[model samples]
Target: MKIKKKKRTSLLYQTNVEYGDWCLNHIENCAHGCKYPCYAMMMAKRFGRIKSYDEWINPILVENSLEILDKEIPKYKDKINFVHLCFTTDPFMYKYPEVVELTLKIIKKLNENDIKITALTKGVLPEILKNFSPENEYGVTLVSLTEHFKTNYEPYAAPFEERLKSLKHLHEAGFRTWVSIEPYPTPNIDPENKIDALLDIVSFADKIVFGRMNYNPEINNFKDARRFFEECSQKVIKFCEQNNKEHHIKFGTRYFDNKNTQTLFNKK
Candidate 1:
């Protein structure tokens, strides 16, 4: 039997996360394509196929996606509470104006049916998000503030300051904003100063998700990275408690023991 291609909206199963029930990718590739040895790229490299992530993962418009959505929504509408945009690529990439417009249109249709829409991006442009509604949640991915680290690891993403500025703009526009601090490499460095800076920018955010580096032998691993990550998590949680901010630390099986971290956070 030949498998039918899904129409306008691609069908995503689900994850344990609270954000969305369905995930859709408007594009196939990521422009930034971090050099710090991402797991996704590692798999692609081992296959000896694509030279760079952009060759395979950068944004590709799915011509049939929108029409597919119009048909699928009626059948699975009850199963979806939220629709997440572009899990594999940034929806706000500089070259995706047409894709962005179609995404906004699809989101509007979803909203009419009571499903929420959320997006996570590196935030290269603030104007791209002008149409997002208050019910839509926006997440900005941030790894480091130091320019040298950012240049080496994330050459294609916008500068740290510009991304923060985009976050601030979304917050001021009345949209729910969040931050994803994943792949925290230089974890031992004191985040007290950095946390202070982030807090100033994301004061309007409803919550934050803290994550550490994924297990990858090829990537440069700092000796004290885990210790620093925990220290930063502690500081962030304490700061959030004092200032009434909500935060969660995500520790997958590869990085740290989940039971120990859970116990540590559970203590009063």
Candidate 2:
């Protein structure tokens, strides 16, 4: 619940995560405290940005983020396909009004320049987001639907139903919407329901991004890990096709049994 501010050199930069998209992490740490070996927290430590998990759970807002964007947006506005709100931190982090204020400003700034924006969050999507350009895309990270799984893994994120409801509202409002089921847990961690059951809930999404968990040793112990993910990935593809939706199976989620690696996104 502690807030701190720090300065950064630039607010926007191209990320190579999937297909070279511009991204910005306006905050240093996340308050969600996700325990699925949070990759952001891990990277923060590896880079000596934070000393411990406790520190990582306390977010540090990027100082003058708006001013930096005001200057940087013009330089890259011509080349940017769309600026992703955040990959390392939540823009609408719960119980943090300042974070939300900054996020609104950033969205407005980019929209004023006719730049597109894409945002993914575990926190509640503010109702005002509907005021933004309809071209902007919004998404939520929803790997599980059970509160038991949420309590154990995502300690501080908004409840699963709340996130879904929020996203559904956005979708209903004619805003482009998506869901990221990235780092989805194997049965050992979730053991609740099949992937289809979960996907059924977010079927309204315009797109779905699915990926298997990584950087976790426990997953490696699951002997059926490879098979489980392959079957799950296939299910996602099938569901997306049947429902006439766009979906992306992240790199490495499916082991190409035929060793033919195609691009991740398959629009139906």
Candidate 3:
């Protein structure tokens, strides 16, 4: 489907997502088409931000985002630490070159107005990123290293190896970098089914967040659910502590592992 473009009344706002206090999405739909199958998409569907699966895949760019932010941002500049580039959409979502260009323009405009930038994407970081201040925080969501899992889950998102390379490059170039290991999938109950993608890139992750696969029956109903998450959390916490990298366990992970599954997605 051809991508849809639209203009909006406003383009910046506050967010409850842990990474940032405020956020701005320059697009209406995400092209990633993740299969967690993306809680963001699920919420968007519920709120009527997107009407259907097909529409969500088609991406709607906020054509006047830069103009809207000019009016909205100055009013909240002092109150905002950094506006995350997106929560509902990937700033670097692959498959659509125009989305990447729009993302770069949005970031440049926000930075020109002295707004800090922070973003986590399933898309690869292009060379254009070097033009921005190294102070901007960058991140990638990596659940596993296997192509099989990614193919079955986050299919349209950047491949795991590509995400790893992106984070590594950012860290090497002196940019503050982080990784999101949330919705860390467990396709089957066996330990062999579990992955150790973290060990592959922990060295460069300036910050890390480990989380359980919330709302997935395959993992939630596993007999070793508690053991798996506990082990993973411990590993992440240990590495973060040893390397002096900032880290957090997503709020409901410990609770879910301890059999408190009800609170998993209860947070806003």
Best by lDDT: 2
The list of candidate 1 runs beyond 4 A from truth reads 1-9, 16-20, 43-51, 125-131, 187-196, 216-221, 253-268
Model 3 misses residue 94 by how many Å? 1.9
Q: Give per-residue CA lDDT, model 3, range 29-114, as digits (tens).
A: 78888777778788899998778877787788888887888798778888877778788889998778888888888888878877
TM-scores, one per candidate: 0.78, 0.94, 0.89
**Candidate lDDT (C-alpha), each:** 0.62, 0.86, 0.76
Provide the global lDDT of candidate 3 against the true structure: 0.76
TM-score, predicted candidate 1 vs. hidden true structure: 0.78
Clashing residue pairs in candidate 2, if any? none
Q: What count of clashes does model 3 give?
A: 0
**CA lDDT of 115 in candidate 2?**
81
lDDT of 3 at 246: 77
Q: Model 2 — which ten-residue stretch has the worst lDDT?
A: 259-268
Off by over 4 Å in 3: 187-197, 256-268
Each model's number of backbone clashes? 13, 0, 0
Question: 267 in model 2: Cα distance from truth in Å?
Answer: 14
Task: Give the C-alpha lDDT of model 2.
Answer: 0.86
Better of 1 and 3 by lDDT: 3
What order do candidates take by TM-score, descending?
Answer: 2, 3, 1
